[model samples]
Target: MNTRVVEIRNPATGAVTGTCQGPTPAGSCPYAGRDGVVPCAGRLVGPAEGDPRCWPVWVPPGCRQCRITFNDQAVACLRAAERYRDQWDAGLHRERERVRALAARKDPRFRGMSDRQLQVTALWRWRLSGPAQGLRHAEQKQRDWGRMYLALAEQQRAATPPVVVGGAA
Candidate 1:
């Protein structure tokens, strides 16, 4: 479906900042037009619950039918975004678990390394066996995960209770 949208751009960089889709040519609603009744003012709304994607929609106090229609359209977009997000999260979780398994399989030679280090090392090991460029994307993913892993590890370490090896000091 061709949804006409106005692209919001950054003034300095001239990059697309965001977009707003509307049902009318004027790019807004709740206005007088050839259709006589343009319904309540429409605008793009989102970063809504369960999704960060926006959708062209109208709010209440106008035609009940129009309001329901707009809301249903918005809900459809949000649901689609939610599904994609769920898949992406699941994939990341699986990848993290796989990395953890790989770390366990390593021998004592890697015993002192942190889990994040082991993950990056594992990626590098794979890179060594293939075309360098082919593993570039995977390497980048590993680096991003490494930073996240380290931050989580730091938080966990800080939250842990100190051990009392013998007796009270």
Candidate 2:
């Protein structure tokens, strides 16, 4: 079966950056151009000039107006968020499994326990803390990083020339 593909390019260097599957030509897919199939036979070309899709994925380094950039500080914050979120999810999953296993045992102590009781037991044993605490910590770190990014963006915007009200007083 024919598959559609979208070729992304870096406008500055005219180099292909990446390609993603586009809609098939059957008119069922949105990304499919006027052509019926998702044009994947050959290398999909980048969008023509003025096409909205030609925009860069990330602002270049040293660009002041960009709210988000691939700077080291921003990248490190993102990595930390991912790591913390993953750890929290894994802990929750392990707690759930432990509760399930405990419930399945025919031991008298667990035999008459309700679902809540089993869950509480698993949580205590796993030392799983409240989600609110974790979320708050992550949010604080994100806010700190966001402030730095915003400051840079504001500085860039201020450096740009302002528009004249009516062609020079």
Using TM-score, give the best candidate's number: 2
Residue 98 Cα positional deviation in candidate 1, in Å, after optimal superposition: 0.6
Residue 140 miss distance in model 2 (angstroms): 4.3
Judged by lDDT against the true structure, how good is candidate 2? 0.49
TM-score of each: 0.30, 0.37
Candidate 1, position 2, lDDT = 29
Q: Encode model 2's per-residue lDDT on 84-127: one tens digit a residue.
A: 76776677668768667867877666788888888777667555
lDDT of each: 0.42, 0.49
Q: Kindly list the per-residue Cα lDDT of model 1 for residues 9-78, writing each as its tens digit.
A: 3333333446544344332443335554433323222222312222222232332222213333434444
Tell how far residue 108 is off in model 1, in angstroms.
Answer: 10
**Clash pairs of candidate 1?**
none
